[model samples]
Target: MPRDTAYLQIADALRERIRAGEWTAGARLPSRARFAEEYAVGQSVAQRAMELLIIEGFLEGRAGSGTYVRGPRRRMRIPRSRLRRLSGPGGRDNGGGTWQSRSKARTPAPERIAARLAIAPGDPCVVTSYAFLSQGRPVETCESWEPMAVTDRTPVVLPENGPLKGAGVIERMRAIGVTVVSATEIPRPARADQARADLLGISVGDLITEIERTHYAADGRPVETADIMVADRRAEVAYEITFGP
Candidate 1:
């Protein structure tokens, strides 16, 4: 190892110690000076090692106090394959946990959303916002858009209204003779904006996962697009793939 990589090596050693239960969760670590002396490294190197662990979520700093191990993270698994299932008569349960939603109708689609749905900007769309919860705590939020051109007068026009309220995109489209065949998602790491942070009960600039999802029909027409946000500390996204013989 190079001389400049000493801090990283120290971080690795600290991480190993943490996993081995040397200092269990909520246990305070030695002061930086003590760490430097124990590891035979300079104070700056020891500080860098501590900083690395903090970023990696292994440890947290308390104001006017020393660093301590973080408790185990809480995580909810979101299965990608389950997005295709509909909630209706004889439909299988989505198992996405419980959720609550509020929706507004006749909202004009934003430019970026228009591009995703392949519709003209400013076109009228039904926007439904959702907040998913676990044990009464907010875990995820989603903003879904469906162009009025496809569902203007249909029973499923508004996602949270009419008989098909709370139904999935596949079921809603199928009811209107639109056969949804495919769905795609693009996920990226992001920081929580002010509004999202408030909704998810997290501080601004906290790490989050943003997923852009789109549903399509058999005729190659776009059915719906949505932006989903989950706090990194609360959920984990997983994809399931199967090979055909």
Candidate 2:
């Protein structure tokens, strides 16, 4: 452990002590001032160290109470299988969680989003956002965008509304005589922003997994695109691929 960074060094020492079961799960920790005194560091440094542990899922904070040891973090597995067809765009996960969604029609697409949909910037689109929770705790979030040129005035216009509600991208498009051929997803590491952190109930600056996904029609036209954000500490993203015969 590098002592140059006082907080991290303190965090390491504290983490080892926690791992040794000195403070069992649900055990209340001493106040920040107490920790600072014991570690011979400033109170702010001790607080930051505790915050790091909280973000790591080893500790939790209570509204009116001090921090306490957290139980083993349960990391849900989120599958990303090429063989599995997506249920439209926003809010798709295999974490056995429920999701709530809100959508808007005729929303204008920004420059980057429009490029993914192969449409001019400001083109009309339907946008949907989803918040996914597992065991009553937030685990993931998604934002989906689809070009109005493809789904406007159609039953699938609103992803979670109408007759084909909750249908997958392929099925929904097929209903309107459009054949979806394939989907592409690009996943990358990201840090939680204030908005995302608040939604996922995680601390800002925490690491997260971001997947950018796009669906395509038979004519090589982009049908839908989405960005999925999963809490890296509470979930694991898995990719399962099999060879074709």
Candidate 3:
């Protein structure tokens, strides 16, 4: 916790405290003025600390309501390439692809997700959310889901636990005995919401990149679906189209 990094230090300290259950969810945090005095720092420093926590999803501030603890953050990462095979009720590979299981995670569904999955707005789905970091800083927050029928199997295997190298989702699934025949990708732009802003440490009005993908297997069966939001500043998806000469 260097002096110049005081705000981040304060935020990290508070984050740890919140995660440790010292400050329960919905518990109001100390006022900026109070924290300034408590920390023997200027009000600006205290305010910066609050902003850091807010951006990191540890705190939420309402218009009329003061800042308070929010529940655990949700982060998701799915490789763009691998085709995960759909497993039957018994978790055996059915020679068809399947989406990731819900049992591996617990996160809230974003409202717009249903449209991407072609499900009714209120329909229940299996969701997996996670954050991707490359250095110590956060890079992107991803939320992806599929109908339960597609992901009922337990322990959906992913690439070995270490950091992903050149392999993408397509390769990992193939390695696991699944094959992908086709994929469709759609792109859109959107205003950053509180959750997105917090996860990416950006402001509410910032532009974010949204990608929706639907994957199909050999028989044209929809095996998996995904919705991903990328921080515009940090990443961009590129592709090269080719035609036979």
RMSDs, each prediction? 4.9, 5.0, 13.5
Cα-based TM-score, every candidate: 0.76, 0.74, 0.45
The whole-model lDDT of each prediction reads 0.78, 0.83, 0.56
Q: Distance (Å) between predicted and true CA of 87, model 2?
A: 3.1
Q: lDDT tens digits, residues 23-70, model 2?
A: 999999999999999988889889989888976778876655788899
Which portions of model 2 show Cα errors greater than 4 Å?
Answer: 1-17, 22-71, 83-85, 88-95
Cα lDDT tens digits for candidate 3, 1-245 = 35688887777777888889998999998888988887777778888887667655678765556888876565333233222211211112212233232223333345576555555666655555545554445455555464554433433432222243124445434553557577777778776788788877765655567777766656565555666666654444443354666
Please list the residue runs of candidate 1 whose C-alpha ends up more than 4 Å from where it truly belongs after superposition.
Answer: 2-11, 17-57, 60-69, 82-97
TM-score of 2: 0.74
Clashing pairs in 1: none
Global fold similarity of model 1 (TM-score): 0.76
> Which model scores highest in lDDT?
2
- For residues 62-103, what per-residue lDDT tens digits would candidate 1 score against the true structure? 655778898546476765654332342111232556778887
Which of the numbered candidates is closest to the native, going by highest TM-score?
A: 1
Q: What lDDT does model 1 reach? A: 0.78
